[model samples]
Target chain A: MIIAIPVEQKDPDACVSSTFGRSGYFLLFDSQTNDFHFLESTFATGQSAGIRAAQLMIDNHVGVLITNRCGENAMRLLSAGNIQVYQTIAGSARDNLERCLAGTLSRL
Target chain B: MKIAVLSGKGGTGKTFVSVNLAYIQDHAAYVDCDVEVPNGHLFLPMDRASFEPVDVMIPSVQTDRCNGCRACVDFCAFHALGYAGGQVIVFDNLCHNCGGCRLLCPQKAIIEHPYNIGSIRTGNFEHVHVVSGSLNPGQMQGSAIIRRMIAQTRPFPNQILDCSPGNSCHVVQGILEADMCILVTEPTVFGANDMRICIELLKLYNKPFGIVINKSLDTRNYIKTFCREQHIKVLAEIPLQPELAVLNANGQLAAKQPEYRRIFQKMLKNAHSLVAPQNL
Candidate 1:
């Protein structure tokens, strides 16, 4: 399963971004392979940035999305794609992902 | 003569001056272009007999003809279109209706459809024809509504366009086609700053304009000094009166009073003289 986490930067140690749409980078982690890749958001500057960000998760074949907050439109699109979105507390990207894996984070 | 009353900031009395001007002048049309919150109807007695919807062309994709190459998605600058699950999806909210997607679609799958975003109402109030546009709540295409409003408006001998407050695209749309612009401002630091920005915009467009000082209290003449320094005319000044404020808040035309009637008449005369000569 591939998980997409909105992060402040491409680095795993970077803080989890507060915004799901305008985040600097989305870290896509494959739990099965234990590998990760950075997916740059095309909607870095757009009106429906959150919706486009959710579409990015769909295009990347992500099964889960980890973020601080998700807008109504983004949540609708993400849910339509059958991608589960989890809300995490303020922490580094690696820490949030670890909590998400342990099933401690709440589903958005 | 088409005169646009505008301001860079809200609560600067653009509507206050505009609605009154239309009421006092003969054969004048009051066009409220502030579609977001068209409160001009409150002050004027609308006939409610004439109204029309403002619609814009939104793109639609023919699924069978689409190859799902994501070309149209990449072409949309507003991010209104996206490609996922081997299909292209359209977000109507973000669509500017620029027709770029339809023009750039390699597979010839995109088509245009009309989407109503607002309504324009026309009525007779106090012997003056009143036309106003009201945008639907949560709609983002304000400029499109203004454009549709202008297209439907019949040119009269005198027209007063009550523009939305702010230095946005919608305000520019209202100002661009006008023969003259009246920037309504108050006597405050923020008012002066915003008025200066508006002045810069007018100068950039090379459009002729004047100033109307509204709600002038016993404060210093900062607005007068700024206009003088910029070589702009102070068309009229409506003194701050508590009774006038009370009347305005209750949607009553302050021009009903003899004093305000004289003020609006003088303003109309001044604006006509400022705009008429250039046309000659």
Candidate 2:
């Protein structure tokens, strides 16, 4: 399973981005392999950035998304993809991902 | 000839000028391109002639025909189309109705559907033919209605387009169709600053425009000085009259007063000469 967290930087300690669609980068963590990778967000230029960001997550096979807020359009798209979006925990990507993995984060 | 009445700032009396000018002009058609809040109709004594819904194309996916190709999803710049879980979803609000998704769909699953955004109302406001486009509440697509409003103009020698405030795409749509523009502005610092942007935009578009100082209060001339410095003509100046506001609030044509009638008539003649000097 892949867990995606919107972050400002590629570092695991980077603070979780408050915005889901216009986030600078997305950190993807693979639960089985315990590996992580970063992908630059492509929806920054358009008004539909949120929808495009959700598509990016869907294409990358991200099973779960963690962010501060998600727009209604993006939320509907992600939910239709069978991806669970969770509100971020109190701190960085590392902390949020830990809470996500522990199944303690609130589902958005 | 089409004359557009515009202002970069709101509450500059663009509608007031447009409606009165249309009423004063002989055999003219008045088009209210301010779809967001079309108040021109309120000032006109118009009976509802016709109402037509204005619709824009929004991409709708035929789920059965979609093959999980994800082509449409990728083609949409607005990310309006989403493909996931072997299904496609169209986010109506995010969709710009560009029709790119439908055009690029390899499976032919994407179809363009009409989404009604607003309506156009046309009627006779006494002698002048009036047309106004009004967008539905909460609708963000004012440009679509403006385009429709311009297209719905009656064939007349003189057409007055009452443009919405600001320099947004909605205002540009109306400005583009006019032969000349009458920039109605107030004599104030904020109005001057906002008018500067509009002046720049008109210059960029290569559209010739004149200024109309509405509600001129103080004897000092700030708008006049700016116009002179910019080499733009002041077509007319409407004095600050409490009676005019009272008349306007009651949907009365203040231009009916002989003095204002002469002012608007002069404005019409000036605007005509600027638009078509050959005809003058």
Candidate 3:
């Protein structure tokens, strides 16, 4: 599974989100089996950015999502598409990605 | 006179007013609470000494203490934690440090630990002391650092807070503690919309405020008329002067412009009059 993930460094497998804007991942993942992407949600999913983000996630067919955190509206949008959101995990991008693959992130 | 300068949108003269006001006052401490993009230092360069690091609480999981009950995740309002299987993966960056995770942890494995998000820097520009805090990039929590900088204040007679542009937590924390807030804006459409939001926030907090039209348009402004209709006092206005922008971009204080200095001096007088009790 070529799973997409959010990483500090923006690489082919990782989409790094910058604190400032559109940089946070609207990542593409080949595998749905493991890992999640971090998503910072706007308060309302109706926002242009948020709407496009939700659409992009669905379009890309990402299986799992790992984000630093998520708000209510964003969670609802992602959930509507059957995407599971795991809450804040703050480590270097690679370390957390490995945990997701192992399915070792459930016991918070 | 503790004054806070704010705008609901970014790039609209919040820092301009702050840096110039500090230069004109030459005695007050200038606090830059916009940790996101603290550009005030560029405007008012000084010999700054770094202040203490700003720390935020992040939840740590102790496997031995956790009993595998997913209560913490179920109770999290922010969805900051979860446990679907027998594994503990902490999203430290996602955590808002709200304590729900620790409180709801069935196994008592969750513990809060301090994490450094950013730091503070203090300096002197002429005689005016300047302090600024910036959030580390990729950290969404900007307000915490802004709050930390304000908490460092000593009850002073006069201080100037050059707030971040926006009604986000960073701006609120910077403005909420102020005796008065100064809304800075231009005469454009973006200015009008953002000013309305920011003005509403000030009203929500019941913080007394007036308006300062920075980079004012040379032709005319319906904004001044709009404010008058809404009963907002106009503290000052600075026209779109190319020289001022150039100097400002070059790391020069706008107040150094003979004209700009005169304008702030006049506004300072008006600021006092607006906030001071009438000697009736």
TM-score for each prediction?
0.91, 0.89, 0.71
Model 2 lDDT per residue over B1-280, tens place = 7888999999999999999999897898999888888888888857867988888988777888888887777777655677878898877756667787777888998778789888988899889999889988866677888877677674687889999899987889878888899999999888998898999999988987999999997697789998888789889989898988999899899888898899999988777667656532
All models: lDDT? 0.85, 0.86, 0.70
Q: Which stretches of candidate 2 lie above 4 Å from their native place?
A: B68-70, B94-98, B219-222, B278-280
The residue-by-residue lDDT of candidate 1 on B131-211, one tens digit each, is 888888877888887877676665687878899888888889888878889999998888888999998888877777999
For model 2 chain A, give the 10-residue run with minimal summed lDDT. Answer: A41-50
- Writing each residue's lDDT as its tens digit, candidate 2 over A25-101 gives 99999999999999997666567788788889998999999999999878988988899989887799999988888
Candidate 1 off by > 4 Å: A9-11, A37-46, A58-61, A79-82, B276-280
**What's the CA error at residue B200 for candidate 1, in Å?**
2.6
By lDDT: ranked, best first = 2, 1, 3
DockQ of each two-chain model: 0.50, 0.74, 0.06
What ranking of all candidate models by TM-score puts the best one first? 1, 2, 3
Name the candidate that leads on DockQ.
2
User: Highest TM-score among the candidates is held by which one?
Assistant: 1
The residue-level lDDT of candidate 1 at A55 comes to 79
